[model samples]
Target: MTQTLTVRRSAFTVALTLPVLATALLALPPGTAAAAAPASGSAIEWGPCAGMSGLDPRQQCGTVPVPLDHADPSGPRIDLAVSRIASGKPAARRGTLLIIPGGPGNAGLHEPSRRGRQLPQSVRDAYDVVSFDPRGTGRSAPVSCGLAHEDLAMERLRPWPAADGSIDANTATARRLADACQAGDTAVLRTMSTRNEARDIDRLRQALGERKLSAWGVSYGTYAGAVYAQMFPHRTDRWVLDSNDDPDPARVARGWLANYAVGVEDSFPDFADFAADPGNPDRLAARPGDVRPLFLALAARLDREPIPWPGANPAQLNGNVLRQTLLDSLYTKQRFPALARLIAAARDGGPLPAPNTPPDEAMQNTVAASLATICNDVDAWSGEGQAVYEKDVADSRARHPLTAGMPVNVMPCAFWDLGPSEPATRITPHGPSNVLMIQNERDVATPLAGARELRDALGDRARMVVVDSVGHAAYVDNGNACGDAKVTRFLLTGERPARDVYCAA
Candidate 1:
């Protein structure tokens, strides 16, 4: 089966009921009381990880049992897959540094070996790096909605409207996905929320016997890290949030999705520069300014006449598919050439590139978890009717033609049956002044605008480092030496710029 073109880094709802508000309040206390503490004498048995290739040999895997429903501690339990690579210089170890993965759906089981090893040696030596697959993901008793193959495509997942700008198909898709998830096993889906993920982190901290956790959270992980900081203020040491999202408590996931319009506009110029350079083989235009128009025209042309692409999801390269490809490619400059090539091929009637899709089973798991987290995070989405969505989509398309209203279009959350179990945790400046945010000036997935929102929300509790680079996830990935140096110093010596600092490309 052709795999869906998933948006790995990129990717809520609802108001708080009285009971939900109380649940949020009860979780404010620091330490074990704030989280569902694991049962006594139930520690993860560290051993070799199965089936993960290229993992660092030093990384060991384990599982910690967290309540399937945190509200009922003695109820059914699910095993959270955890991984760790002990400090290279254990004698100099200060504490644990949790490597939080993004996507809300992305697994962190391999992060201890992948991103963990990428850290500076001094930073690595200072802490035992650890990560985990949040509940309902990876080996943590995974859940799937069993969505059909076509529904898993990027254009559908991102809710791109029809070529005519009508959102009828998109709305239908939203309702269908919502129904599928509702009919599937919802036990684990109900438990998948950012708040619960924070609670899960605390549980892991307890299992590891750490009093506090210093963490590096990127992309969606940044939002997760902020929530953790808010819910357990005293338990976080040095915090690093990269490529942040807007943390409007009322909007939550909704705001993050809508921000893509701004993010793409911010990041596209860099790709235009690369794609229009005279020296580039895949140059799209004679001038950087022309690249945008060329792309737009090509997309419009494809909308009217899609080229058949055998063995690919949806089996053709249409305007929305091209648009989705552009969105995915803009995540990093390293991917710019691929986008350029695809655009050039589609325009010239060349053979289509092979589709990159994950196994059906993996796609199902990721989509299910992602939908559950965003939909179950809050009830804010349920109130927006189809007419409201149509107006929003039209407005979004008018303002941002590149994204074609997909960012603000209807999603499964709009039709989700299960409302939030608890209120979305509002991140505030009330936490310890220990956060350091690093953001790319032009990140498509998590734009600077949203990062600033998060930075502002944290108030005096955080300082931000703005890197004059394009792409997602600053600090060692798509970041300058100045920004990397700043983050590394903070991790190693607990030093931050006295205030927000900017780094030139």
Candidate 2:
């Protein structure tokens, strides 16, 4: 199914609520909180935001200066674009709540106003909602590799292997992208690791005059939040990590990339069931049992003979493109029609769906930042060249064909220009018991298994609320009131479920 080709950005929208601090801290003197204030500095000089849409007029924008490399606190600094909507009831305000976005590259400057709108009025009145564009994204100092239009497309950017599980194209593409990024702005690119992002958040906190800040982090933001909690436990007030990631420091980004294999397998059945429902206007099969084989056959046929698709960067409806579309459409139920229609069009030899075309610059910035963080956060890439990747791809394809071995395929990280400045921070149980994790039963990006890894790592410091729902997020977008209510209650009242619990859909 050909759709308007938008610059492929890898991010999902999610809402969040937070937990209260350690019980011991609750006993502190009412007048003073130990980690409640940072070194005093000039107050934020708020001004009208320009070019950003869907934000309240009252939403104010500003910037904070942070060391480009936290190692040198006095070294060169960079500006981080931040936005905030002050508490409507200052007397009732609990403190500041930082909203962290999903993608390692996604901009969250509008989140304070966007997601804030969905939050309960009590939660809103209790905190100053805030978010920002991470180091190399959005209104902050952005970076780009100036990748070719084709390279920037979602299908190509995801490293999907050619149909027979061959990774020849993936390897060459990885090298091309890695070289371009290395040749671009090396300094800024090198500073774009999860660790640096966490540090940047700390800097933002200090600049905001909050010694400790509460946070609601989603997707990749969950990882960044975990690192922050691990590195600066005392600096955290309340933390809500939604759709968690595995905190395996050794496999940092590599594990996340590879997790697509399990994630797709875990979530595809939901899509299949949807596609085969006779009542579905866009149903693709007569029965749920027939959906999988039908999709596999159609994908194979496209692999053998692609249809010409004008206006798209690659200009053809190839097998990998269809596969990429399938992966994307599974993210949420609303996108199911796009996939079903694409399949119907492809099967019936009709015109492909129009793709959503985002500006080229937006694509460049997102792709560059994603690569920088994944590559700089850890040394997971084997650097063993094409032959090894080929073997891994073949093996993965045999086991999980739905993913076409792309999850295990080579990426630019194998050829990254720089290594992690420091090892990825290991998440542990040493932090205060201030974290509450909420996850959907099936998530395409961050799977439940990975969420479990994080939960295990946090041990007694956290409680997880598992939602009996499909798709990525457990909050706003996913229609699970049971899950939403639990999360909302916890954030609003500092009340967590006594133990791990499940919320039925």
Candidate 3:
């Protein structure tokens, strides 16, 4: 999973939402009108998943039925698919921990199974780890915009401007996508956002019979978890916000989109280093200095004349494709080979290999959810005049040649006709002082800079652990034993740094 730099970026999606980590359970808040949740059964029921199957008798999965509207519980109800890995040490178990995944589009329903092996045993023994797909996502009732095949392509969906820096195409795409979503089954799509997700979490809490929930929220999920804690402080417990994002109350998703430029700058060097490594089978350069020029020249060539790639989703190596590729490759160290291969193939005057395309069903659900959350979070139509964005897009193309004009261009939100379903919930500092933030020094999607904003917003309620790393999401992507140890230690016990801790690179 990558940081969707978006245009629904692939490969570069790994900002937070890592495998597992620790954080102690917390007690709920007092002197507040926190509503009591619904009645829930006491046990987890087992089932099979793509990960470790029935062999792990402790793991169970089921659909936790919830109302489409919590205000009207008797109204139309939808089911949220869920998975739980019950406490291995029942005697030592304290409570439940919710695994909040990043990506407004990303779902964590499979996490308990996918990451059951990664959790430290003490953390595992103490809590029944649970994760779920938010509404309009996996196993839950999903929304589809009925976009055309070409419209589903990453570049088009993300509103990457024309190579000439013209937004005429972007405007058209916005209209088309907006019309498609509005004309299709949009009831669910219209209602999706971080605010609703917070409501949904509360319902899940009631359904699970847990008095309080300890959470491990990553990337986009960190924002969601923060909003949840603010709205229902009494229900939250020891929370871990790893690889955090900006809580720019006004431009939540837009801020997320703009972070791509810094993200690329922060990460491209890693790609360059990997491309220059001596033994790399697909080394693009023998020295780090040569990698940037090589990528830039290749991208410019592709922009003027795209490489033919029939059968691929977008079917060409145009400027945005190159830009999109650059964003995707920055998420992980292992992806250096991919950037090198793409550059080599394009430079050799040959057809670039087909890029990965998720199944139509998966892509549709992802796009729909991504759009819904962004649109519903805040009005993205920056009405500050397209001049700034257009000029910025051009400047971005010149500055960050790898991303072309995608990061700074107009998006569907710019031309959207709808207002938010609800205002973004404010992340108040008046909650439990149980938040532990772990972030990498350089993150492409949710950069460390944004994490600091989140840390500041939380004030005294959270502790910071900045790992001297260059990738997005630290716990898993950083591969730093020191950073990993700090998080695992805090989660197993209620221990925390007396002040902000920074791990050496």
Candidate 4:
């Protein structure tokens, strides 16, 4: 779930790399006044959302105040920006359906307007769709590490190993990024963790006056939703976790990053099929079997003799850049063409496509928040040093050449200044049986293996609908009609499969 700074049509655009250490929440900085608390039970004074042109006209924006540290409710506070598109049919409305976004860093306040519009009519009529910017993202008391533009590039941010498989530069970069975060806004950044996000969701629930909440969480949102259901089991109604993560509390984000090795192996075949199809405008090979070797050879060649691409990030089409592109492209089949075209250009000496780097300021904000949440979520990764990471990278590269050692390489977390405030929350099968999970069989970000781990963790409290599809999200995005129908039915009628089911592609 590495954030792509490039603009794309999908909601799954947040990056996921790096880490931060957790420690006791920093004391309020000297002379900085704590934010005033909001009056209890005050309703959001909804109004036109600024800077969100092209948003659904019905979508209204507001903010809710929550403690900067949930552990100290009366201490300092920050506002969480929230948005809602009320039920299309108020009389038919059942309750609020929260849309938890992915990335841990992704701002979800606009999801109600974007993804909400894609909901089936029955769902739109049945609930007031709501979303929010998690504590340190978007307009919700946003934070930045003021990262240098060069460091913010995806190639650097994702920790791709040196062309020769050495992690020396990656290790150095990790330390530098960690130091930047330590020096910049440590107070607010330390508060960014999955546990606090769940707490913030509850605070948002209270502000919206919902006694209970039904939700649809995608990608990283799935993990956050699972945590919320665990923390406030009674407050959950119908819950849907799409594109789930492995809730191995001990590994947490570290496990998630390492999972990319398996995820890419599982997803690459789909891309191969797309690239080898004769009907595809950007076909890479005549036979599906040839695509893998061709890509490997081309990447290897690029590693040795990189192409100079003037406008692209890093200003070159090198092997790691190509590998990063493939990883990003595997998120969905719709992105397959882009990957194919890049390969064609690289192999044929054609012009490279323009790079889609996001604004430097936005990249800084997202990278900072992503690092904070993952690092602070668990301390499992804290003690690993250069040797440990080198071994991991070497092993990963040997087994999964497509992702190389990027997934297992060191991140900012290894050098973080703080430590986790509390132990990571272990998701267990003790919650209400309102949970339903829909997962793509070959999601490159949150693969089926991790989803199955979450399913096993949830036990009978959850039922899974595995779609024989490819891509990151399952429901209504990359899933087939069969999968979509099943998920929509559950959200609209609270009916789940009697046992785990599979929908054909």
Candidate 5:
């Protein structure tokens, strides 16, 4: 079976000891249709959440309605699945703290409860932690392209080109996915841009009766949070964007996708060190310098002679699949062993491991929502021909073989049938100066360079903490004590670093 990319980035969390709030009723009125719209001043009738086991019993689930198209206020409306864990001590309560999840498609509905567990007592006591599923995600009117199970595979969705650096198959996949999304549901799909999500957030704040919202947004959520700050500056309180993204309006998602090249290169040395450590049980190489070459050679060999594996996507282990696995595993240190095991097994011609397969319907929704957002967030790529993409991919492959030219490869956005409803929102220093950024020095998703770009764009409005750690995100997960301390302090007391500072790993 061909291994498919099934690794999804995780939400960052800390291991702080905080008081758990008492069990409370779920919010939002009964008979609320999944797509029901709420009035601006309408209060969510608090009620028991169903289906989420191990979640805090006090975590309440509700829905907020926002205009499907913000322009047509009185037109069609869509529901946003929301959850909240109110501050335990109202006497010390400050205000609302929104916990934005990563991924354009990742559901934030349970993030508040999950992440809230890691917050310091003071921080948890200071504000209500809340999160929501964006317009076309999860319980918020979930949408799918009705795509085939194979089409929904992460390997297929991520556009890993042919081994020869040819984008012919990639281009075809892009067109197929794009066409499927466009032909499926125009209303929800076309409305799944970042701008709309940000607007939906504001509507949520209003429904909660909060004048301003403080937020901790991670990964792609950082971009959404920045957009929210830019669009509704007065509505923002203390904002912390961890593992930031480049807010270059000209290249939104495209820039992020491209940064994977630099990101992987920047973080590969860390992986090399691990792979070469003699103490490591699954070390892939005897010397640190040999790891990269070994990985590249292994991938090339697989490209030439794909190993047959039953039960996995495509039923074979090809080079790009291995590359995808490597890229996904690089997201965190804990995931290193998975990649090492694969490399060690492959080196011995051992049996391939069983692949992780997420529910097809879930991936269908995720990929569809992700594509819709990226394609509609900005005017990034054009419907260029395969030759153009092939040349670009070939050049990138030569320049950065670690990524196998996948970073610059064509994706559904290139052949997207829809365009942004408006130009991408430009993030500026014009917002509140309460923004604080925490980033890892070696992030495989959003690199340090991109975080610097965002810091530069935010100007005096933001200050960044560069953690000397390796991996994605900085606060809580994949970050050191110094970094986590600084972020927690800022979240609790609004005391940001006097100037940009570095936290040694």
Candidate 6:
């Protein structure tokens, strides 16, 4: 990944350690639907949660009924799964702040209970924290491709080119998967664009009767929050976008997909350093000199002669399969062992161990959801033919050898037939002036370059903090004191950094 020293960009209130379950939440009956909130300002109707079980009486869970297509609110609709732990401290209660997670596939409904528990008291005290599962994810109106059991494999789901760069199988897989999505609900699948998601957010805001929303959006959710802030600026207050992405209007998710190659390049060094550590029992190399070469050699060898990995999702370990495994494992330092173990075994000419595989029922759900959201969002493969990507895969394989042709290669999106419902919405300076950005200096998925682009796109409307660190995300990923303090302070108080500051790693 290229390190961009960027200046093109221009780019939260709260204070307190919020209580476990806000007293404000306890005031409302549990399990009330998000839609049930009356239009009355400052006073929301409440009821017991319908699906919540085993929770303390304070926790509330319910569904938010939203138009499948905002253009046709009276038509088909779906529910967004939601949960809330009202502000624990009634004294500092400001308003609700929604936590939007990444993955376009990540489930946030449980976050008010999981990640929310970690908020500083000031932040927790002031905000009635709420989170939800976006449409087609988690407990919402879920959609599955009904993919074959074998296709659920991650290596297969993401297109990894053949050893010699032939993309025949990739084309087939792309076509097969895209066909499944097209055959599903032609109406709602088309409704999965971020614009619709933004409209759904405003609807939620209107239902809650809040003049403004305090939001924490991370990764893919940053784009969602940015869109919400842009489309309904008056309704937003104290917006923080962490681990941002490139908000390129022309490509949208296409650009995001392509960014994966550079994302790996930016993040792999940390993994390299971890594997080079002297104390690592599963260390692949004694000296730092041996790490890259050893990884490259193992991948190339797997390309020339594959290994059998029975019990893994795909059941057989092929070249691209090993490459894909390497890519996913690079996301965290703790997972370095999975890569090292594979390399050490390959180097010693020993039998590669059988990978553990659990029941793939949930795996099916994950795969389907990933596709449904990505495909539903944008038209990735179009006039951009495979020729450009073929060269890219071959060139990237030569340059980064460890990841082989996996990241830059063709994916199911290459064959997707659906076009974006509307041109990708360009996030502009048109939104409210109250937005803060928190970024890790080195992020894998949402790289600094893209974040700079997003910052520039937002113009003078936002401020940013670059945490001196290397990882996929900053918040919850790095424990930097300054980074956390800056984030916590912003979330609790309406204050922001005097100027954009860079905290040392």
Q: Candidates' lDDT values, in order? A: 0.83, 0.80, 0.74, 0.84, 0.80, 0.69
Candidate 1 lDDT, tens digit per residue, 209-255? 87778899989899999998887777778889988988988989988
Better of 1 and 3 by TM-score: 1
RMSD of each: 5.8, 6.8, 7.4, 9.3, 9.9, 9.5
What is the lDDT, from 0 to 100, of the residue 219 in candidate 5?
A: 97
Give the per-residue lDDT digits (tens) of candidate 2, residues 392-460.
888988998888888888888777756565666777777577788999888888999999999999887
Candidate 4 clashes between residue pairs 3 or more apart in a chain or in different chains? 2-15, 2-16, 3-14, 3-15, 3-16, 20-375, 21-418, 22-419, 22-420, 23-419
| Clashing pairs in model 2, backbone N/Cα/C closer than 3 A | 3-354, 3-355, 4-354, 4-355, 4-356, 5-355, 37-211
For model 3, which pairs clash? 2-12, 2-13, 2-14, 3-12, 3-13, 22-491, 23-491, 29-234
Query: By TM-score, how accurate is candidate 2?
Result: 0.91
Off by over 4 Å in 5: 1-42
Q: What would you estimate as the lDDT of candidate 1?
A: 0.83
Candidate 3, residue 172: lDDT: 64
The residue-level lDDT of candidate 5 at 378 comes to 71
TM-score of each: 0.92, 0.91, 0.88, 0.91, 0.90, 0.86
Q: Write the per-residue lDDT of candidate 3 for residues 1-505, one digit (tens) a residue.
A: 1111222211121122211112232433221223223225553344765453433566677777777765567999888878888886767787777899788988777777666567778888878889988999877887778777888888787767776677767766776687677776666776687877988887888778888788888889899999887777767667788889899887888888888887888888888888899988988888998998888877777779887777667887787778777787778766767778888888887556667767777788888788878876786554646566677888887886666767777777664544464456555566567778999887889888888889998887788899887766777555788788877776666566778899997
Winner by TM-score:
1
Report the poorest 10 consecutive residues by lDDT, candidate 4.
1-10
Name the TM-score of candidate 1.
0.92
List candidate 4 segments past 4 Å from native.
Answer: 1-42
lDDT tens digits, residues 1-505, model 6?
Answer: 2111111110111122322111111111111112112224533344565665654456577777898866567987888777778877776777888888677766676677777777777787888787777777768777667778778777777777777776667767777777776677655554665766777777777666676788889888899888776666666677889999898876677677667777777777777777889898877777776777777666777778777676787766666777776677766566778778877777787777768564566565566666656655555455456567677778877776666666666566655555455555667665445678999876767888889999998876787889877766676556888878877776666666767789887
Total residue pair clashes for candidate 1: 7
Stretches of candidate 6 off by over 4 Å are 1-58, 349-359
